[model samples]
Target chain A: MALLEVKDLKVRVEEREILHGLTLTVNEGEIHAIMGPNGSGKSTLSHVIAGKPGYEVTDGQILFKGEDLLEMAPEERAAKGVFLAFQYPVEIPGVTTMNFLRTALNAQRKARGESELMVPDFLKKVREVSKSLNIPQDMLKRGVNVGFSGGEKKRNEVLQMALFEPSLCILDEMDSGLDIDALRIAADGVNALHSPKRAMVVITHYQRLLNYIVPDVVHVMSKGRVVKSGGKELALELEESGYTQFEDAA
Target chain B: MNVAVAKTGSGRAVSDLFASAEGRLPGSPSVIASRREAFETYERLGLPHRRIEEWKYTDLRALVGEVLPLAAAPDAAALKRAADAVKAHAIAGARKLVLVDGVFAADLSDVRALTAEAGFRTLRETLEKDAGLLTTASTDAVIALNAAMATDGVVLSIADGAQLSAPIQIIHIATAASASAFTRSQVVIGKGARATLVESFVAAGAKAYQVNDAVIVTVGDDADVAHIRLMDDAPDAVNVTSHFVTVGANVKLNFFNMTTGAAVSRLQGLITLAGEGSELSANGVNLLQKTEHGDTTLVVDHAVPNCVSREVFRAVIDDRAHSVFQGRIIVRPDAQKTDGKMMTRALLLSDEAEADNKPELEIFADDVSCGHGATSGALDDSLLFYLKARGLPEKQAQALLIQAFVGEAVEQIADDGLREHVIGIAERWLERRS
Candidate 1:
């Protein structure tokens, strides 16, 4: 069975429908990329999976590890090993990255009946993880995402995912506003943290990020639903040809 | 509305209280005599009433028109226990200034670091001294009242350019039935010095207690002073704390009032940017419930050129609770190049909860940038739905969103430990409310 399975999902935001009918399955260790234009519901798909508020699942079911995932809470979903890298990470001032990360990690750990990580041990592990992502240790002491550059904020999200070590990580427009160097750095950070026990859903408008962290499956999403599924080469074809064809097809 | 009309009543109440408190002081006759005159004047003026335009929204008259006589404290043992309990809740590692039942508890407070030569003294000592230190009338009615009636408070002074590593916690605990307690604190930061102060008022097992508190702070050239108030008491409690701060050239001053108590709790700041290049930041976080009302008001004056002032206040009102914020930024004609910004935001969690915000920018200088805005709204269903989609319970998601909303103001606070403590308080409040 797949690690995450969504069968005939129908989601709505407000009275208007955003996701009419969507179905997908992600097996462990596979990286799937969803490419689409603006208003394609790509971000909505990622947000819904991560349990963001506003978008409602009106029908169908989402099963994660054989359990009904749609019924769980956001933090519960997080504790169950799902992480969402927000398209626009909210800036939470007064909460240092270190403190927030520690709280989130301990919350997840405690939910699983695990012992609390010692402050020193946790700090050491965080520092190590940040170093691998090329994020400055000084930034970790600052407020979460406050005054962070676009790329820095994106990298911070990946850093959080790495520290949390979730089973399924959703990246929402992780490549937007990233320069060439930052794109490589962020993609490398995600690639380094990838493991056989983890599955990832990457949402993007462009195919640039795929160059660094190539995906095993690619899907074309438009008007709130995925219309086509293919391999990595499909991304290059769409990138070179533009979304004119897929926009009509989807 | 004209705040000047209410000035008279506020002055009278202030004078009466000052005289009543100072009359009992055992001190040099000379200092006492002058204070006595001021007290007489304060009593004649009395606390301001709502009929007065300036005091309209506050309605201080209603809060204290009855003038509950200041009752003597309860048993000494109980008062001492309350002080000890307060000492435990103080900002960790910060110096403690404990006031039990309206009187300074010397044993519970740390006085070893204080010195008369350094301008640090208890209100008692200041009264006995020949020093001609007196308070002048201002727009703040509460200040006059506090100055006239304050029975006990603190005098904190940092030497020129001395940086204090730890925050200072002034703990006021009132454990009395049918009693009124008054607290006053005076703080002076010398040139280039830096310090953070936390004023905590916690009431324990008190029935119908009234606390009138006041704090006066002065920051010298290049000095930085941060004042944080953490108030957690029963809903029957009544508290009115006023802060008067004067900033010298190049000094930086911040006042943060976080209140979570009382049937009617009002905190106000009367700040004066007296010298060029001075800066002031005033912020407040008020979380209220039931028919509770919490008011955070300020009157900021830019008396000198190149002065800067920033004010941000956020409130979360649930049930039938109410939160009021009235901020006034006045830039004088000669105070050119002054930059002042004020923003007050409120989150109404319940339909019955109400918020009143009046932010004014009075600019007399052509080169000044001063503006104020106030916004009030309930939790957006859209934001809530986003969190719910992630599998969070509706209540928990609302809590997170509420925390995030207020966190905007909290992030500006510089102290890490205190920030976390306030966040913890927010979390606890949300859990109880939820």
Candidate 2:
């Protein structure tokens, strides 16, 4: 069975249909990249899939592990191993990165009937993950992304994906605002999460990020539906030929 | 309605009580005639109330309906015990001062250098010099109402350039009921000195109601003082709170008040940036449940130039509880570069909960950044759903989000111990409800 199965799913934001009868199925152990131009509803697809507020699933349905996805809340979706690395991560003030991450992790563990980790043990893991991301331990104590630079915000999002180790990760504009060094670190974070049992949907506008975490399937999302699905070579062809060809085809 | 006032024969007794409360002046312990003159000033200024624009939200008319009695001599044994408990149980980093019925307990308190010079005396000494202090006690209507009412208070002073390494805490315990207690305290953080005063007013268990009055604190030039008041009086207690603060040239003061107890509580703070380049930041967090009614009305007057003022208030009200936050930030015409920001956000924890947030900014100067905002609403279901979807139980998710919301204010507390203490209280409250 596919890890995620979307059958003719329709979604709306503020009564405006953003996802019109879209269908896509992803099996475990595969990395899929959804590439599209601006206003192609890429970000909206990710947010709606994560159950963000104000986005209504009007028709059809989404099945995660054969269970209805639309009925769940955003946090519940997260606990179910559906992670959305927001293109623009919300800055929640007065909430320390350490506190938020710990709460999120323990929450998932408790749901799976797992034993809670001690503070010291959790702190140790946090320190290790932070160091791997080149994030200082001090930043963990500061409010989440309050004073972070643009690149830092993207890196922070990647760090969360790595820490949670979600089963299905969706990267939204992960390459935007990243410097060359930051870009490598971000790609490395995603690459580390790659496994046969896990799946990822990398959403981006440019072919720049695809070079690092090459997707098994490259899907072009335009005007709400996935217009075309092709192998990795299609990304190169599109990069060289530009998306105008798809716009014409649509 | 008019709950505080009692009928005296046929006339309204409130005006009469305050006029006497007003006539009573500077607690003159001194026999000298000059001391009498200062008392005259107290008479002239009179006791302020809701009729006064600044005191509108806090209706003390009913609060001062009955005349309060002068505080009885403190329960010496109980005062000492409370003092010992604080010293041993507090955040080991706290410097404590014990006051029974508003009178400083020398044997129980730890105020260094105050005994040697600067002619600083205890509240007891202040009373001796100012005989009128006791007469006007709760009777001045404010303190006269408090003296006529409060049991005791603590007098404190921080010398020039002397920075206390720990938070100085004043502990006031009331042992009487029915009769009110008027407690008066004066705290002076001298020039260039940095200190923090934490006043905890916890009443000794009692059945009758108690009224508390206190006016203490003067921050000097270039001085920095962080004043925190945690009012956790008895549930049956009826409190009328008032505190006056004056900050000198280039001084910075951060004042916070948290009221988690009392039947009906009203707190008022009058802050003045008395000199140039001074700053005052006042923040309050009120968590009221049941039918509890709490009000925090404040005035931050920027009388000098190059000074800044910021005030933010947050509240979590549940059940039929009511809360009011009336804040006024005034930038006088000559007060330039006055950056004042005020925000009040509240969460209606239940359908019956009520909250009134009044944010006012009166800026007379053109070169000033003054803005104010007020917001009140129920918990955001999406945020709650987000947390619950994260696998947390419905109650746990709600609790976590609530904690984070309140944590926004608690994180600003500089002292980690105090910050943790506040979070612990919030966490406990959430746990109980969950």
Candidate 3:
């Protein structure tokens, strides 16, 4: 069975429909990329899967590990190993990064019916992961995402994903606002988290990010649904065609 | 439409009690005269009502219902109850000065632990000979009433250039039910001296009790003083406290007040920059729940040049509770080069909860930089969702955001230990609610 199965999903936000009859599937150990233009509902798909509020799934079924995914709360879905890296990370004042990460990790552990990680052990793991991401230890002491550069915010997202170790990872425009060097660093972090039992769905507007974290399959999404699905070479084909023909087809 | 103001009989009750307790209250010959004058003023003004602009949010006459009988001297049982209350709210590494039933408890308090440069005496003892120190420094009606009815408190004096190693804690415990306690205290810091003073008020099995308290502080030139007040009385207690402070030249004053208890409570601060180059930061937090009404009002005056003052306040209200913050800054014409800023924010946790924030600035000096802001809001839904998405349950997410909301103002504490201590108290408050 596939790790995630979406059957003809239709989502409405504020009484206005955004995702219309979209369906996709992801198996374990496979990396799938969804390429689309602006307002193509790519981010909406990621948010719906993560159980964000205000997005109603009108007619669809989302099955994760053969269980109904829509019925669980956002935090429950997180514990069930569904993670979505936000495109625009929020800055929360007065909440230190270290404190937020610890609370989140322990909460997830508790939801899974497991004992919480000890403080000393948690600190050791955090320090080890943050060092490789080039995030200063002092930054962890500061407020979460406060005074952080765009690159720093993206790197922090990767750090959280690594710590949570989600079974299904959805990266929504993670390459936006990152320079060449930062891009490589973030890609390396994602590559390190890749495992045979874990699946990833990468959604982006351009094919540039695919060069670093290459995917086995790429789907062309437009007008609220996927129009085409092919191998990695299909990304290069669309990059050369500039998505104009795809827009016409939609 | 016309509204008829009802003649409240409760206001007359307060005046009647003062008239009956006049000669019986403790005071010297001169102090007796002052008390008579203060009582006349209280009678003329009556209890402040919603008609008054300053007391619009907190109508003393209406909310107080009826005047509580004056608290009598504590007996052996009452004293034991107060001692137990003191032990529960004690702060670590501080010299304690306990007051039971509004009278200083000698057996419970110890001043010998204080440094040699400090001199301490009871206010009742000092009032026996000299009444000049008990003179009224504020024009507020409730404050004048406190001055007239105050029975016992502490008079602490620190010598010049003395830096006390430990903080001084004045613990006020109430053991009487359906009664009132009035206490007055004063602290005088000499030139270049340093000290930390903490005032905590708690109750032991008291219901519908009333407490009227006052504190007067004078910071000498180049001196540093930090004052912290924690008010956690009985659930149905009514508390009203006033602080009068004067900051001298190049002096540093840090004042923080936290109110987590009481059904009806109000804390008023009247401060003045009496000298140049002085800096003052006054911060407060009010955590209220269930039908409680909490008010924090401040009137800061920058009367000299080259002075700076910052005021930050936060309130977290739940269940039908109401929180009020009124901050006014006045920069005199001669007070040029003054930098004054004030911000007050409130977080409402329930549908029926209410928060009223009023921040006003009156600047007559063009060379000064002064501003004020007030905001009242519920928790940000996006922030809550963000935390929840990270795996925190709904309750834990809301608690985290509420802590961060109040943490902004609590972090203004200059002393590290006091800051952490205040944060710890705030967290426990959240824990209890959740």
Candidate 4:
């Protein structure tokens, strides 16, 4: 069975249709990169899957682990092991990174009928995870994403993704606004989280990020639909040839 | 030609209250004369209405339709209830000066310990000897009414160059229902003295009561003061508080006010920087729910040069609650090099909830750098979605965002314990909301 199956998904936001019959499928242990030109509806697909508000699902269905994913709330989708790494992580001025992580983790645990992590255990786990990501302890002490550099915000998102350990992860333009070093660090973090039990959808316009994460399959999106799907070589092919052909074909 | 002013029902009630309670009220002949003069001022002004610019957002004449009679002096049972109320609202490690039903409760306060450090006298005692305490030059109707009707309050004087070790908690507890309590207190921090003062309004076995409380604080030169006001009245109570503060040269003042429990309340702060090189950090938070109405109006006056003042106020309105914030920063012509910035933000949780934010700046000094901003908004969709996507339910996510919203202002509290205490109150409010 597929980990995530989107069958002819049509979505509209604010009376304008953004996703026109987009279809995709993901299996466990797979890393799929969705490459597209601007206005390809790549982000719309990710946000729709994550159950973000303001998007109306006009047609089709989303199945997660053989269950209707569209029927669940965003948090429910999260507790069911689905995560979306935001393209532009918001700056929450008063919520500390540590507090946010703890609240999110505990909330998910409780929703899954699991006991909450004790304070000491939670602290130890956070410290270990943050250290591996090279995040300073002081950064975690500060407000979530507030005053964080581009790299730090990306790293923080990756940290959340790692801690949540979802079954399906969606990275939305994670490589944008990052320099080479910062991109490498963020990509490394993503790469380290790959597991046979998890599936990932990496959405980006640039193939430069695929060089680090190394997707198993590449899908080219154009005009709200997947116009092409091929092996990993498709990413390098498109990067070299540009998205003009795909855009024209769609 | 003098036009006759017709008194509203509340105004007439208040006048009759003073007429009936005058004989029983405390103070000597001179004090009585001062009270009569203040009452005349109140008669002239009547209850402030919506037409008054300062009371534009809050109309006392309408909201306070009928004034309750003065609360009787607390009896033995009432005192017992007030004792329990103090335990609930008291900040740990702080010496308490308690007032029950508008009169000082020395037995419940740390009077002996506090007296050892500073001069401690009730307004009842001070008014007996000196009428000057009640003579405030201001024409504000509420202050004048308080001057006319105030029964008992603390009159504390910290000697020059004295440094108190523990924070002072002035706990006002109401123990009667359908009654009013008008109390006025003053604190004089001598030159170079350091103190932390916390004024809390709570209730024990009280409902539908009214509280009109005022406090005057004078910080001497080089003194450092942290004044925190927490109002958690009964669910159906009406509370009005006035803070008159004067900061002297080279003084540091951190002021914070949090209102969570009152059904209808207004906290007005008139802070004046009278001396040079003073810094004032004023922060406030109003967490209102249901049909509650909470307003915080502040006037920060920079009377001298080289003073810096910052005001941050946050209001979170839920259900049909209404929250208003009015902040004005005035820089006098001679107050050059003054840096004053004021920001007020309101978060409306429900469609029916209302928030009014008005920020004004009156600057006569060309060299002064002054700015004011006001913003009213609901929770950010993107921020909320981010939190929800991370596994927080909608309610939990909203709570987190609201906490973060008010946390900016609450963080200005200088002491860690006090800050946490304020946060705890906010958390409990959130819990009740959920």
DockQ-superior candidate, 2 or 4: 4
lDDT of 3 by residue, B150-225 (tens): 8889899988888988889999999999988989999999999999998998888878899999888889999998
Please provide, for model 2 over A82-157, each residue's C-alpha lDDT reduced to its tens digit, 9 standing for 90 to 100. 8888777666566678887788788877766788778999888888877887888888888778798777777787
- Candidates in order have lDDT scores of 0.78, 0.72, 0.88, 0.91
Q: Report the C-alpha lDDT of model 1 over B140-202, residue by residue, as the tens digit.
A: 555554454556678878888888877878888877866778767788888999888888888
- TM-score, model 1 to reference: 0.79
Write down the TM-score of every candidate.
Answer: 0.79, 0.76, 0.95, 0.95
Name the candidate, 1 or 4, with the larger DockQ value.
4
Clashes of 3: 0
The deviation in Å at residue A77 for candidate 2 is: 3.1
The stretch of ten residues in a row with the least summed lDDT in candidate 1 chain A is A90-99
The best candidate by lDDT is 4
The lDDT-based order of candidates, best leading, equals 4, 3, 1, 2
TM-score of the second chain of model 4 compared to its true counterpart: 0.97
Q: In each prediction, how many residue pairs overlap at the backbone (N, C-alpha, C within less than 3 A)?
A: 34, 51, 0, 0
